[model samples]
Target: WVDAPNLASRILSMTQKRIAHDWMHCYQYAPVLIETFVETPRFPGTCYKAANWTWLGTTKGVGRLGNSHKPTLPQKNIWVYPLKKRFRQILCSNVQ
Candidate 1:
């Protein structure tokens, strides 16, 4: 991990807002949500938590290979942020 100034939390919030704005205005599309994964073994998701992102869960870190499942990668904690006020409603409506 590159050692930089301690501005991760602020940067995350700013970046997410900018993305939502650009998508809605420039592309005429509104993003409902955003997600990120953090490798908890290496780094806890303090920035995401500080930005008010919800901690969903951790990945299984395994995939089924034929009849058996094997570990393929390290488990990562899942985090998500709603970009829209009615993100859940929007998402559910899009499901088919």
Candidate 2:
């Protein structure tokens, strides 16, 4: 949705700060990544790409509500923004 002024990047920065602040205050630990989904058909996720978020992949279009394991929902592209440089290490650490 970033047209010209590039509000998405600013919003993402603000959101990251807010998330870090809230999580640190509530749980004493902050999250390592921020993930978002974009419907590729409708939106090309240009905002995320412009903000330097990494593209992970596309979803399988599966709904997690019932036992039906069919691909019913619309597929969405996955993107992630790492809050920390060592996010992989932090996420994969066994010392938790």
Best by lDDT: 2
- Candidate 1 residue runs with Cα over 4 Å from true position: 1-6, 24-28, 63-68
lDDT tens readout by residue for model 2, 6-41: 788888878876997799999998999989999877
Candidate closest to the true structure, highest TM-score? 2
lDDT of 1 by residue, 1-96 (tens): 977775888788788879978887889987889999898789999988888899999988774452446657788999999888988898899688
Q: What are the RMSDs of all candidates, in order?
A: 3.8, 3.1
Whole-model lDDT for model 2 versus the true structure?
0.88
On a 0 to 100 scale, what is the lDDT of residue 78 in model 2?
A: 99
What is the alpha-carbon RMSD of candidate 1 to the true structure? Answer: 3.8
Q: What local distance difference test score does each model get? A: 0.85, 0.88
| Segments of candidate 2 deviating more than 4 angstroms | 1-4
